[model samples]
Target: MDPRDWLARNTFHHSAFQDLRRLVAEKERQGLRLSLCIPTLNEEKTIGKEIMLLRAELVSRYPLFDEIAVIDSGSSDRTREVAAAFGADVYESADILPETGTRRGKGENLWKAIYQLAGDIIVYLDADIKNIRPHFAYGLVGPLIERPEVRYVKAFYDRPLAGAGGTRPSGGGRVTEILIRPLFSLFFPDLAALIQPLSGEYAVRRETLERLSFPIGYGVETAHLMDVYRAHGLEAFAQTDLDRRVHRNQSTGDLGRMAFGILQTFLSRLRPGGGAEALPELHAMLRQFQARDNAYELVEHHIVEEERPPMIDLPAYRQRRGLPP
Candidate 1:
């Protein structure tokens, strides 16, 4: 399909799905179940409002999300407490699949959510959004509930870099502009059409998610788009315009770390039929320099990009979901 045609047909604005009642009716008619998963890590400052707003609007008021859950990465702060207080079913990442062991990253929580949450359709969101609104949830979910051809809905928006007093209208997603987009333009031209390929907000069907692997790091979102597009093609994917998204800011150094992790994920997909295993396992240690007293010191930061297998292949998960062996 032509990029322009795909953008015109698959891309949508939030207003198109503003009628909550009609969307709910379509969901019920299809006998679909919905789950909202917020992957968190030390987000006490904003977790509470994120949960309260989404729960009140999507879960209680509209009945769009049957359950709202927070899958955390063992936060030292009050993130879990605040989320639980706001009526969210909070689970520590370590506790979800104890037998399989655990790794820490936003992707870990997202991967485990497939097992922990009961929704047939899982909508994953980041926990640190200062401007938490219904559109973030509904916009992603609307496309799937309305169009059967659409298996995944990703959120794209005018990302305003948030700060203490206000926000810069543009300038966030340093890693995407610097690394992922240019890379995509070269290899995966069709995927470059995605406004925010690394956006954390998306809703995916159980069948679509169960077949893909999850990278437990910055690479997960990018990997998902590449993997899903490979298996299902452009026809199965859709993107929504959420107007604007305001989230916490990260420094260039932090973005460098993120870019490193995402690079490994992207390279793994490049190998002919490689898809991660096709390339040698990437190293977790990222070496950077710290300057002090006009002297440079080498600092090796361990940033492992561990991946979880497709949920459908696990016996325990299959049994829990009552699927045949």
Candidate 2:
């Protein structure tokens, strides 16, 4: 069966499992050690609340997670301070492994977290989630903890758009449902089943996670969904509805830039004619002329691909362990 059919039959909403207490019990019975990871960049306003709520309800109250950590992309704001104040272990992506060199983006933080944190299951949540709640973490982690067959869980929600005037009750993420979804439907129909394929919240088994390569930028979530599906098929995935998420709105220009980066990453993977194709040489910084003291200043940045080799090619990989080379 196709992924949409699989999602229709197997996908679940957080509302379906509101009883977090039951979910906790099942986690213990399975001897699962859960961890919550939030990737942030200038999220001081919301990170504090997110950590407080999850730590109080999911950690202190129910003992659901073994650790709650915030992996940041060098936020100059009080994001790291605020998260630490709320009792979360906050670490800078650059500090995680100084040897590897740091890259700027959400994927960089997440990739480092996998190496820094220890847990049987890792639940990655976005730092800017305003309507933060315990379910945001538990809802996504619950499925993987309960079902051994389920390897990954993606989060989707009712998003309310924020504008200069106010907030829109309905439409949000114009680029997603309109552009990305149609693209997926045309080429990767099975992937289209992922309601919010770009959603920043998700959970995955440590085994599955260590095997996948992370794209350290806007393309992380998309790359994850595509990579995991290619390796494990539709049955290995699940999704949960996390209600509404309110956050700062992105301008058309910003969204356009994001879409462009995602497209480049997506097409690189989808292209068929490939035989040691030369990898694209990516540039990180752009020079723009600004009226600053009547002089133009040049900014420097290092943009790197940090490409993740396919897991199937690894001899130590679970899927390839016993197969003859």
| Worst 10-residue lDDT window, candidate 1 | 163-172
Q: What tens digits encode model 1's per-residue C-alpha lDDT throughout 160-271?
A: 3344666454422778787888988887889888888888899999999988899999899989988998998888889988878788788877888898899888887787
lDDT of each: 0.87, 0.77
In model 2, the Cα lDDT at residue 208 comes to: 86
Error of 2 at 184 (Å): 1.4
User: Which regions in candidate 1 have their CA more than 4 angstroms from the true location?
Assistant: 159-172, 272-284
Give candidates' CA RMSD values in order: 4.1, 6.0
Give the poorly placed runs of model 2, Cα more than 4 Å off: 159-172, 272-325
RMSD of 2: 6.0
